[model samples]
Each structure stands twice: as C-alpha cells, then as structure tokens.
Target chain A: MAYNLWYWPGIQGRGEFVRLSMEAGGIEYRDCAREEGAHALIENMATFDRPPYAPPYLELDGHAIAQVANILLFLGDRDHLAPSNMNDRYWLHQVELTIADMVAEVHNVHHPVGSGAYYEDQKEEAARAAKQFREERMPKFLRHFEAAAKSNEGDWLIDHRWCYTDCSLFQLVEGLRYMFPKRMKTLEPDLPKLIGIHDAVAELPGIKAYLDSNRRLAFNEDGIFRHYPELDAA
Target chain B: MAYNLWYWPGIQGRGEFVRLSMEAGGIEYRDCAREEGAHALIENMATFDRPPYAPPYLELDGHAIAQVANILLFLGDRDHLAPSNMNDRYWLHQVELTIADMVAEVHNVHHPVGSGAYYEDQKEEAARAAKQFREERMPKFLRHFEAAAKSNEGDWLIDHRWCYTDCSLFQLVEGLRYMFPKRMKTLEPDLPKLIGIHDAVAELPGIKAYLDSNRRLAFNEDGIFRHYPELDAA
Candidate 1:
C-alpha cells in the first residue's frame, strides 16, 4: 500500500533521510508536504491521533509514525530494507540511532544557541561550534561509522546488503560535503568505506533518478546542514 | 538473565534512564561501571564485538545493545515495560526518541560549542543556549510530552500502564527541576499531566526503593542536566 510522508517542503532536513530510504527501497509513497505546501503539513499534524513533535512523519495504513529513526525502522522492515535476522535488525537500528545523534550534532553546529534563533544571530557561537565539530566531532563520528561498515563482510552496514542505514549514511555524507566542503575534503581520505557507501548509493537507479529529477530539493541555508563558508575548515 | 550495564560512574547522565526502567521493571542487571570504575567502562566497551558509539550500553545474553532508546526498547518489550500491542510499542518508542532529543538539547545548553569544550570556556555561549532552552525548547518538549501523557487514559504514556517512557519522563522532569528550578516552577502549572506522571513514577515501589538506595546517583554538574544559576530564569 502507498503511504503519505509529511515534512517541510523547501528544506531537506530530516525528511530527506526518509525520502532516500523509500526511494532506494522502491517503496510507494506520496511526498504530501512537498505537494500540498508546508501549511498543509502543519494542519495535517493537528489531525493525527498521535501527533509528532516535529515534521518528517510517515502515515502508513492510517497510522502516523514520527521520528526519523523510528520511521526508518518501520519502513526498513516492511520493505526489506533491513536484515531478516532479528538481532541484526537491532544492530542496524543501533547504528542508525548513532547516525541520528551525529545528525543532531551537525545541526547544532549551526544553531548552537537554539533552533529558535536564526543562524545569523548565532554566527559567532556557530563558528565555535563549527570548529569543534570539524576538528573533533566529525572525524570521531566518521570513524565509528567506518568501523561499523568494516565490521560486516561487505560495504553495507549489515550482512553485505544495502539497507535503510546505508541510504542514511549516503545522505549524511552528502550533507557533510555540502555543509563543510573544505572539512569533508580533508576527512574524505580517511573515510574510504563511508565514501564508498556514498558512491554506491548514488549509483542506485532509484536514487540516481530521484537526484536527477526536480523532486530532490537542493541543500540550502534553511536545512539542517547549511553551508556558511566561515563555518568551514580544512 | 542478569545483564551488565557499562556507563561512566559518578553521574546519572543518560544511564539513569536505563537504570530507572530496569529498576522499575525489577529486571536483573549489574551497574558494572559503578561497581568498577569509569576506566573499566571504557575497557569493557573495547571487548564488544559490535561496539556501542557511547556508554549506557547493556550487555545481555552475549550481545550488547547501545543507544538508550534501543536498549529500552529491548528491555521494555521483554519485561512488559511497554504496551503489548505492536503499534503502541512504536508510539512509545517515538516518545522515547523525542525524550532522547530533549536530553541532547539539555546537554547542549552547557556544552553548546562541543562536548570536548569545557562549560567555563563556553559559558558565554552557554548563557545564550540556556536562555533559548529555558524559554523556548524546554516548554515545547514538555508540552509535547504532556500531550502524549494526556492522549492516554491515565497518568502514564500508554494503555493506562506505566512504561519505560514514564520513567524517562520522570527523569526528564527531575533533571529539568535540578537544572532550572525557577523555570520549572513557572511552567509546572501548564504541565499538570507530565508532573502527575513524574509523581506517579516516583511513587512506584521499585523506583522508590532505587531512589532511596545508594545505587541512585544524585544529579550533578557532570551529568546531562547541569544546574547553573546563570542559565535559569523564572
């Protein structure tokens, strides 16, 4: 059955993680917010019996599932985007949650004061956050992900098969590159496995098609990963 | 089965969330780090075949589960700390993940520049982050959780039964009170349901015993929620 995905229209944000997974799994779903405008998304959230704290919720068979990692867990199981083994599924989820943590950290680099404040307002704090993120946090997170990838026999995080976590890793690497080109360029040499996953996910026919199509939103200042040249480092 | 939990000693931090659930559920577990030391916690992490990105990891049977929400999902299901229904489990998990998000934000209030940087070094930035957290983020999160508690029939988050999410909510409120007593005093009236859950969870036989025992650590500056007078507003 087809599902409805709700998120802000103009920015990729966390919604892009869900979008990439659905696209890669060839799951049938409607990008409801993108089609109906972000106001519809806000209005739709009010109608949910179980409201999400934020956007990027997925409505499946009349139930709304929120939280990017939770939604991915549901879709991953239903669409075979996760491993069949139960333990492996938990392991995969553990990795996804860590990725989620890193993503949150990435967002905080640009909005260290709070999301309520504009980036321009917190530019000085953002610069400090960015330096710490680039110098210490990014490499630490990348190494953890690379180790996870290395744990399995193949390039994927689990059982040598591409999964929802792989799609998310692809998006994460892409976002990092967009947000900190100079930093990413410096770190890429050390993240061969992560970069490999990114390259492989890019070549997937569905993801390639989505990326080339107008449906894929460009990364901008409004999104979780914003590129301010001043925040970048080498 | 007895499980071993590895986390930093001398701080409640995120590990308290897991400890509360297990204690409330009467699940058998060892606080390995507290029994040993922080160095032991780090050393134990190295032994894991699939290492956790950070602490508060539970080692069960032969496998280790990391990520507080992931570990709670595992324990909550096995020990009836979550609803029996599948969809309700997802809803509970969604709330827990949101709680996790708020916890991260709580930590960031003091450590906005990076976890690597000291609060003293970032105190100026922390003041700004704390203002936004106390004024904007805390209320938004508390309201969402209060709404979740209200969505159910009782003081708990689901099916009129106490779950791991309830324990987490109790801890969240406790941490907030410690971090921002004046702010919580002002917001408490609007969070009747949330406060009710906190009071109810606090009164649980298991939780009360744990709180009275030496096993329960006091909230401190070292933990995720830090009390800084400069950060609090009424």
Candidate 2:
C-alpha cells in the first residue's frame, strides 16, 4: 500500500526526516503536498475529524499518523528501518527524539523570540540563540550522537544495520552544514563518526537516487535550517 | 520488579509527566532522583555506558529508557495505561507526542532566546514569546485537544479508559494554570472537555494520593511552567 505523506510543498522541513527514511527504505509513498498544492494539503488535513496539530502526517489504511518521530516509529517498525528487537527499537527511538529536539532548537535559532514573529524582528535574539546553538548545543549534541555511535562497534548508530536514525542524522548534518557552514567546518574533523554516517547514508541507492532527483528539495531561507551568515562562526 | 525513575530533584518538570502516568496506572517505580540527592542522580547517570540525553529516564531490568514520551509509551504498554488495539495505541501516542510539542513550546516561552541564557537576560524576548503563547498557542492547543476529545464519544483523549495522554494533559493544564492563571481562567470556560479530563484524571485514586503526597512537586520558576505575572493576561 502506498502511503500518503502530507507536508508543506516548498521546503524540506521536519517532513524531510520521514521522507529520507521512506526513500532509504524503498517504501511506497507519495509526497501529497508536493504532488498536489499547499491548499490541497491544508484541505486534506481539515478532512480528518481529529486532525493532526500540523503537517508531516502519514496516512495509511485510512489512519493518520502525526509527529515526526512518531511517524518514523511506525514506518521504522513497518519497513524494518528500525531494529528487529523491541529494546533496540526504543534505543533507536531515543536518538530520533533527540534529533527532533535538535531540530526544534535549529528552528529556534532563526525565530528565537517566537514562531509568530518575523525573523527580521527577532534577528538580535536569533543571533544570541544561534550562538548558543552553534557554539554550545551543536557540539554537545554531535558529541552525544558520536558517543552513541561509538558505543556500538559498527558504523551505524545502532547495531550493524542502518536504521531511520541514520537517515535523520544525515539530514541533520546536511541541514547544519548548510545553515552553519563555518561552525560545521571547524567541528567536522572532531565528528568523524557522525560525518561518516552522513556520508554512508548519502551513498545508499534509494537515497542517492532521490537526492540526485528533483524530488529532494534544496535548502533555502524559507526552511527550518535557514542560512544566515551572521548566525554562524568559525 | 520495581522500576527506577531518574530526574531532577526539584520542581515537577518533565519528570512529572512520567510520575503522573505511573501514579494513574498504579505502577511500581521509585523516584530515584528524589530519594537520592541531585549529585547521586548525576553520578548514577554517569554510570550508564549509553547514557540518555537527559533525565526522566526509567531503569527497568538493567535497561534504561529516556525521553518522556518514550518512557510513557513503554510504561503505557506495560501497565495497560494505553489502548490494547494497535491503532488506538498509535492515536494515543500521537496525542501524547502533540502534548510533548506543547511542553517544549511552554518551556520556550520562558527561554525564548536560548536555554543557556538566563531568563532575566532575555526577559524582553520572553515577554513577546509569552504573549503569543498565552493568547494564540494556549487557545489553539486547547481547542485542538477539545476537538480530539469530542471526536471520540469518550471523555478521555483516546479510548473511554484513562490513558497516559490524560495524565500528561492533566499536567499540561495544571502547569499552564500555574503559569498563566488569568489566561487559563479566561480560556477554561471555553474548554470544558479538556478541563473535564483534567478534573477526572485528578480524581483517579493513585493520582489523587500522589498529588496529596510530597511525590508530586510544586510548580516553581525552576520548572518548565514558571509563573511570571508579566507573561499572563486576563
């Protein structure tokens, strides 16, 4: 059965994590918002009697699943993108949740004061927030992920097999590099394992094809990981 | 076997979500951080080879599970705090995840600029953030929850029985009321179903006793829902 994935059309926001996982797993799914228009997405979301809080919901067998990590959790279990064992699945989930946390932080770096406020209005606060995110949080999260990677004697984040966490991490690294080129440049050498996983995921047949295609949206200022030169430093 | 829960000592922070679930479910778990000192909590965390991103972790049968929603998902399934059917479980999980989203947003209202910076340092930004939260987000989330409640012909967020989502929603209402009394007072009249579930959850035998006991810590500035009069409106 093909999955109906609904997200905003233009930019790869949190939805990209789910998309990357599907693409990597070779799962059958349609980017509903992209194929249709943004208006169709909103109208479809409204049709759900108990609609999700936001976009990036997956509709399968007439059931709508929301939340990036929650969606990944379902897809991971279904597509075997998560570990076979339940215990390991939870561990992989922990990493996904952490990635979600970092994603939220990444968005805050641009709109620090509030999501309702314009980025220009909160530029000063964004700079302060971005500094903490880049200088302190980025390194800390990368180190935490690195530690998780090293704990297992494999290149993957967990076990020897690739999981959805790896795909999400690949996106996280790509987004971070685009948003904070200088900071990532300085930190890349120290985060060899994370960098390795990012590179490895990029090489996956499905992901490689998808990334090379127009299906993969380019990073832009409109997206979560927006590039603002002022927000990054070496 | 009893489970061990590790979280910060003071304030009903994120840990409260876990505590409320265990309480409502009548599950056996020790508040590790509360019984042991804060230093002990840190020392214990250091012992984990694959340490969690942060506390509010559950140590069960030598395996540690972190992330509030992840912990709740495990405990919900274990203690039957969640629905038995797989679809309802996912639906419950979706609501729980949405509640988690609001919790993150709630925390952001206080630390709008950055978690590293003091609230006092970013009071102006927080004031702007809190206004949007109190006026727009508070109503939006509550209305969305109310719709969820109305969708099912049940009082609980999911099935007729009390699920872990109810407990988290209870905490959300309690925290929001503490953080924004005037705002909640104005909005509560329009949110009967949410308030009804909040009241019903409190009436649960285990939860009632726990709230009365010292196990349920009081809300304070140190916690996610800090009551700053400036952040609220009538």
Candidate 3:
C-alpha cells in the first residue's frame, strides 16, 4: 500500500524533509497535496480521525503521522533510516530535532513577526533576525552537529551508515546555501564532517534517483528556506 | 539511577515540558543544571562530547538527550508516557509537536526577534508581535488543538487514556494563563476538550506530587513563558 504525503505543492518547506526520507528509504508514497491541490490537503486533514496541527503529515497504512521529525522516526524504524541499537536511535532523534530547530530558525529569520505576515512586510525585523541567524545561530548549530558527527569514527552521524540525520543535514546545508550563500561559504570550512554527511546522502542511490527526477522540489521563496540575498553576509 | 536534567533554573521554560513528562510518568530525575550553578551548565555544555544546541537536555544512564520534544519522546517510550501501539505513538508525537509550536509562539510574543536580544531592545517590535500572536495565532492554534482533541476520544488526543500530549496541553494552559490571562479566559470556553486534557494532566498522581513539592519551578521573567502584562491582552 502507498502512503499518502500531504503538503503544499508550490514549495518544498518542511515537507521536503519527509519526501527526502521516503525517497531515500524507497517507500511507496503519494505526494497527495502536491498531486491534488491545497484544498485536497485541507479536506484530508479535516477528515483525519485525529487531526494534525499543521501540514506535512504522512498517512501510512491508515494512520496520519504529522511533524517532520515524527514522520522521520516512523520511517527511520521501518526503512532502516534509524540505527539498530536503542541508544543510537535516541541520538539520531537528538540530531534530527537539532535540524528541526535550525529549520524553525530559518523560517523565523524570514518571518520574525507572524506566519500570517509576509516577509516583505516584515523585512526590517527579518533583517535583524537574519543577522543573528546567519552569524551566531548558524555557526552555533553547525558546531553542535559537527561535534556530534565527530564523536563517531566514520563519516555519517552514526558512523558508516546513512541515517535520517544525514538526509536532514543535506537539506540543512542545501537550504542554507540557497538562503545564505555568503554565510555558508565561511561556515562550511568549520564543519567538514557535516559536509561529508551531505556528500554521502547525495550519493545514496534512491536519493540520487529522486533528486535527478521531477519529484524533488526546488527551494523557492514560497518555502521555509527562501533566498533573500540582502539577508546574507560573511 | 536517577536521570540528570540540565536546564537553566528559575523558570518552567522549555525545561518544564521535560520535567512535566517525567513527573507525570512517575520517573525519578534530578534537575541537574538547576541544582548546579549557572556557570556549571555553561562549563558542562562546553565539555560535552556531543554538545547540545540548547538547554532542557536529559542525561539518562550515560546518554544525553537534548531538545524538549526529544527529551519527552525519550521518557515517553521508556516510562510508558506514550501509547503502546505504533499508530497511537505516532499521533502522540503529532500532538506533542503542536504543543511545541504553541510554546514557540509564546516565546516569540515577548522576544519577537528571537531570544538573542533583550525585550527592552525590541520592545516596540515585540508589542506588534505580541498583538498578532494574541489576536491571531493563539486562536488558530487553540482551535486546531480543540478539533484534534475532539476528533480523538474524550480527554487525550488518541483516547481516554492519558498520553504525553496531555502533559503538554497542561503546560500550554499554564503558560497561556500566565502570559495572557484575559485572552485565555475568553478562549477557554471555546476549547472544552483542550481544557479537559489540561485539567486531567494537572490532577495526575505524580504531577500532583511533583508540583506540590519545590521540585516544580514557577514561571518567571527568566523563562520562555513570562508574564509581562503589556504582552497580554487586557
């Protein structure tokens, strides 16, 4: 049976994380909201037995799994996106949540006021927010992730294997590059292991196939990670 | 062995969510960072092999779990804080992320530009941010949660049995009441099931014992959920 993935069609946003994990794990799934329409997502969400608080929810078998990290956790166990050991699984989640925190900060840099408001309207605050995000927050988060990757001997987060954290690190790097090109150039050198994780994930057979295909959505201004050249700096 | 929870002392903040989950589950854990001096927290994080991005990390056995949602997820699985079934566990996480979203907005109401700056530095912007949050975002989030609770069985998100989501709901209500008493009073009538979940969790056996003791921290200016009268609606 195919799982149903519901998210906005126009942009990747948080939904791309779920899509990446699914594609990497070779899971059969439908990008329902993208295939149908935004209204289909709305209707499906309403019809859900236990409604999700936001979009980017996945329906497997019959259950709808919301939250990007939670969806990855489900897929992690099912498709070997997680490490086999219990402590390994726990640490994988810690790294995943760290990725989610960065994602949230990325969104905040664009919309510091409210999601209801446009970035253009909140540009002044966004600039101030972006300064902290691009300078302090970005480096600090990258350092933590760098240390996490360094703790293990091998390239990936859990060493030798590509887990969900690897896929998320790839997205984080990709999104940061698109969002803050100038800042990423400097930060990249500070985190070689993270770059290795990114390279390894990009080389994953299924992920490579998905990225080469039309299924993968590009980073647009409509998504969480938007490129505002003015918001970037060294 | 007792778990060591490391978070800044003096406020419920992000750490409280983890505290509530452990308390509700009847798990014995120490408020490590709170007991240790603030300088110790800074030093401990500096020495951590796999560094945490922020506070509210739980050190269990020898593993350190960071991120509020992640810490709760760890305890949920270990102490039976979540439902046994896979689907129920997924839904529990879905609801928990929504609570995380709510908590985030609460933090943003005061620190509109993110926590890197002081409230005085961004007071004007924070006022506008708080207005949008109190007037728009809170209602939308509350309605989504109310619908979610209603769609599930009686009290909890999935069924009559209490889940980790219930503890989060309790924190949401407690935070809202502290931050926006007037606004929450008006919103409460419309959110019966949401309120019921809060009430149920508040009266849980372990939580009652925990809160009654000095183990539970009160909401203060130092924490995420602060009570600034101006930020609240009169």
- Chain A: TM-score in each candidate? 0.97, 0.97, 0.97
* Model 1 bad stretches (over 4 Å): none
B-chain TM-score of model 2: 0.97
Q: How should the candidates be ordered by DockQ, best one leading? A: 1, 2, 3
Give TM-scores for every candidate, taking all chains together and pairing residue i with residue i.
0.98, 0.98, 0.96
Best by lDDT: 1
Worst 10 residues of 3 chain A by lDDT: A56-65
Q: Point to the candidate with the largest DockQ.
A: 1
Given candidate 1, what's the lDDT at residue A40?
92
The residue-by-residue lDDT of candidate 1 on B1-234, one tens digit each, is 688988899999999999999999998888998889988888888776677899989887667799999999988877788977879988999999999999999999999987897899999899989998888898899999888888887668877679999999999999999999999999999999899999999999999999999999999988898899999999
Pairs with steric clashes in candidate 1: none
Of candidates 3 and 1, the better by lDDT: 1
lDDT of each: 0.90, 0.88, 0.84
List ranges where model 2 is wrong by over 4 Å.
none
